[model samples]
Target chain A: MPKVTIDGHEIEVSQGTTIMQATKQLAIEVPYYCWHPGLSVAGNCRMCLVDVEGPPKPQIACYTQVTEGMVVHTQSEKAKKARKGTLEFLLSNHPLDCPVCDQAGECDLQNFYMDHGQYDSRFDEQKHKKKKAQPVGENVMLDQERCVLCSRCVRFCDEITGTGELGIVNRGSHEEITVFPGKEVNNAYSGNVVDICPVGALTDRDFRFKCRVWYLSSQDSVCPGCSQGCNIRIDSNLSRPQHGEGERVMRLKPRENLNVNDYWMCDEGRYNYNFIDRNRIQTASRVKEGVVEEILFEDAVDSLASVLGDAVREQRHGRIGVLVSTQLTNEDLFFVKKFFKTNLGMDAVESRFSFPEGSSDDFLIKADKSPNTAGAQALEVIASGTYQSGEDLIDKTIAGEFDVLISFGVDIDGLLGKEKLDAILEKVTLLAYVGSNHNETSKKAQLVIPSTVYAEKDGTFTNVHGRVQRIWPAFPPLGQARPEWQIICDLSEKTGFSVSADDAESIFSEITQTVSSFQGLSYEKLGKEGSLLSTVKETVEK
Target chain B: MEIPEELKKKWDEAVARYEEKRAALLPVLRLSQDHFGYISAEVEEAVAHYMGTTPVHIREVVTFYELFHTKPVGKNNIQFCHTLACNLNGCEPLIKQLKEKIGIKEGETSSDGKYSFSRAECLGACEMAPMMKINKDIYGPLDKDKLNEIIENL
Candidate 1:
């Protein structure tokens, strides 16, 4: 341990600790662009100037290691003037296009300006201009004018993503961040470049101009787009009274938790919420004799219980099939399985656990599309088929002479090629489809229950790696839709298996009590930040 | 390109004031560019290899930190910082007038290679943007005619 005095505050830090680390530990963040926790240090910004007691010239705290009895002043007049000078010089060539920059509120340059600006423009000359924006990747846009040349995003690609696509082209102030000749900045983690850019230099092609960050209400959640379930922050402006009132998530960013995806999220997860935002089939409408009439959720549930219950009671238990999607939350999966097994005494709860294969990146994630196949497996939910797995549920549906079958899912029909699913649905006498989207199965269902989208539902999704993460509701349920857990609980009451399902805790307990893999997983333990419940892994070290 | 033994020895002595081999990037770039009008890939590669880093890393520093060069240039590098505050005062016309006076475009080297004009990001002189740096000399607070006169005299 070493004793260091930073800004007159005496502090003790571990040996070999940099002055930058000490500053951060002391709740004093040194403004920098080139130094990221995950990457090697390249102190190019020079904005993190500090007056070390012994050094005649100011040292960049990012690279300077703290020694015993060392004194550092980050707020000294000399240090202040030095940082201000650095900022002013940076601004001389910078185009203050904050109005146009997508990274406006969250930009580091903006933060540094407010912290160090002398409130005076010293330049009596013209500003240098560069290209406004260049689309560098499938999901990344580079604005050369807004770039401070800190090279954080460029470093992120080379070091973390291992994709050495982005580089600095040309030279001097004429220098701009660009990809190498003939190569676009296309990498699986290319979106992370937009996240790391200190200035508005790199912007996401997907999130540009959707809504300003100041207006976004953020909620901690995990990406259900894949089994990796990278922890994320869902930012939205849905709480605004001006917009058609509903908490609509505008963007998804990686929350900085070293345990999960470290400051990086896949573009698929970040952009997948767009479908959920607009296409929520949130109404119980039945086309009886082509006269489509909207019915209340209660009436629909009652009818569903009676018809399915009578059909199952008459025909038999195994004849009534059930489909549970891997996309369903742990609580949702538990109750859906329970509704068939306990209430109907029907054991044909066919597993809807399947998706198209996605390629993995060098960063922290699996390419598997469904977030919770492993959890579904724990609940005895088998994959429908190998290649097109969810279709096996329908394959079994065709072979098994069933009177009624209940399938619950989102993205099931899309997974099970449209024609095949449609043809299978025609043969079934009674079909109940529950999901967030109006897929082909939902359209053919005798009863359709609109389940809350992952963003609007608070529950748990077990990622492919067996990491159980908490996905919280970013907004209120849309159009009388309920969380799958609540709806399944409602069905339980109607069918004579009465149980309360007020909170995720109650439902989770029922799951852990019966389910072997989820034995220790309690709602209280399933933190808002999320915990990985992997059956395959060993330690919690990232 | 091989440096003279005298200057190389001098640089070696002066390098220790800074920490790490990479800290010498600015001085090395300036010295090389000064000795032989510009910095080529050969010199940058040799330096980077010796520094135990990639050429791209050194290239990023040279491209970013204003004090480095990556291409062949004229004897004098003429850089003008035309940013927002500077533009408000009148740099647009000044640059246009300078182009006419010098008979050269903004990013072009003179036919004789005696002078090359380019843009500087900030030059640490925001107060003097719309300002021109000729080699090491900085001149600001100018009208279009003033730039015309200055380059004409040069």
Candidate 2:
């Protein structure tokens, strides 16, 4: 180990650690643009210049390694001058389009300029021009006039995904980032370039000019698009509903979690968050005779409990079928198991209702689209270990095996066409749906209850690798929607099997007690990056 | 684009001379420019494919140097030195004279495809200052009559 002092703070690091890494240990701020921890060092962006005791001039902190008894000063006058000069040259060609730029608030260039910039402009020359608003990929927009040529996006494509689609063409003042003449950057992780670009050069096409980032509030959550369980921060528009056409969620940014997705996520998960606010079932409703009447959530749950409680009390467990979707979180799944399987002893309870598999790669996207298949499997709710049992549930319902049926977040029409779903609706006397989004199943169910999506609830999800991670809500449930566990608890009390846990944390504690895989785990222990299941931990230790 | 057998042999020798394939990019580009009149986009793509790299990477190198022309050159390619040595030796007046006679400026070719004009950094002949190269021949230290006579015969 080598001991180095950075700005009067001393720390010991490994032999090959850089000065920037040492500054990070001491909580010293060294501004940078091209030095991403996940990407290789380009050393072109001179924003991280720092003064060393031995070097004649300021050295770049990102590439200069520390030695024994080395003294470095990140806030020295020489280092500050170097940084000011670098920023001045970088902004010499920058078109001051801050008022219309989408990355005005969260851009590092703007943030660093406010912290360490020399405000007065010495440049009176006309700024160089390049192409603007070029769609480089399906989800990424490129503005060449604002680029500082850090080469982070070019290096990201070259080293990370191994898809060398971007490069800096020409030289000097005429240089700009571009793909081939006719080709485009259409990789599986293309949206991440917009996240890694330090300036407004690359912006998300889906989120461009939708709403200003300062008006949006963010919360940590997990992406429910697949079993990969990539950690994310959900940004919602709470104050202004007129910005994104009355949409609540503004965007989803990938949170750094080394255990799961590191710092990158697939485009499939990044752009699939509109379902949280679009086409949602705003209020509970019941189908009376042939027309649907809007009702309160209390009336819908009470009427459902009366019919299901009667069926279970008459020893007609064989006639009641409960189909749960794997999209429910672990806390939600635990309550579902407690109310339906434990109290009623229903034999036809299934959670692995199948849907169409999505396109996957060896990187982040998973073939199983649901985020909590492993959670359902760990709780012993999904018996077959496969997500292809929706056909079986539909077949049983069509054959008149069950007089009552309830499902959560399952689209039966999408799984087996509208004809089979119509058949099940005709046979079952009472078809109830407890989900967030509106679909054919929600439209046809006799009783419909609105529930919160993953972004609007606090819970944990066990990923495909058996790591249980936590998710916090970005906002309250939309309109009159409630968390699924709260709905289940209300139904349990009305059905003569009342449970005690009220919040998501207490319900997860109950899960840790009952499920063998989730033993000795709590929300405090799960933290941001999750904890692997006990069974997985034992196997990994071996 | 099919590379000729002799050019492929030269490319193999160039790759073997360097430890890495990409280190041989300059020599390979030079060979392509000598065989083909100018390095077009097709030739750049062919050279990049032969070197196991990308066309954008090759395009960056092609645009950096003044000698590597990207478009087809004329029958006579004329280059006038424009660095400190030539500027001190009264090369600007001679260059201006040639530009008016050629009916084109720097970085432009003649309309009849008979002449092309450009400014070079240094030709490594500072002793023969105020020099200009035309079709692999160098002429310098001349008066206005000698310069006009040389172009008139061509």
| DockQ scores of all models, one per candidate | 0.18, 0.64
| Each model's Cα RMSD | 8.9, 2.2
Best model number under TM-score: 2
Per-residue lDDT tens digits for candidate 2, residues A1-542, read 99999999889999999999899888899999999998999899999999999979999999999999999999999998899899988889999899999999998889888888947998888888899999998999999998989999888888878787788987788889988777788888998899999999999999999999999998999999999999998998989889999888888999998778889999889999888988999899999989999998899999999988888779886787778888899988888888787787876778866567889887788989999999998997752322246568668789887788888878787778899889988898888999999999999999999999999899999898999999998888988899889998899889888765769999999888878889999999999888999988533210
For model 1, what is the alpha-carbon lDDT of residue A261?
77
| Model 2 fnat value | 0.50
- Per-residue error for A174 in candidate 2, Å, reads 2.1
Query: What clash count goes with each model?
Result: 20, 0
Best by the DockQ measure: 2
Q: Which stretches of candidate 2 lie over 4 Å from their true place?
A: A383-388, A538-542, B135-137
Estimate every model's Cα lDDT from 0 to 1: 0.75, 0.88
Tens digits of lDDT, candidate 1, B35-112: 666667666665555556655556666666545666677776788777777677677788777777667887888989
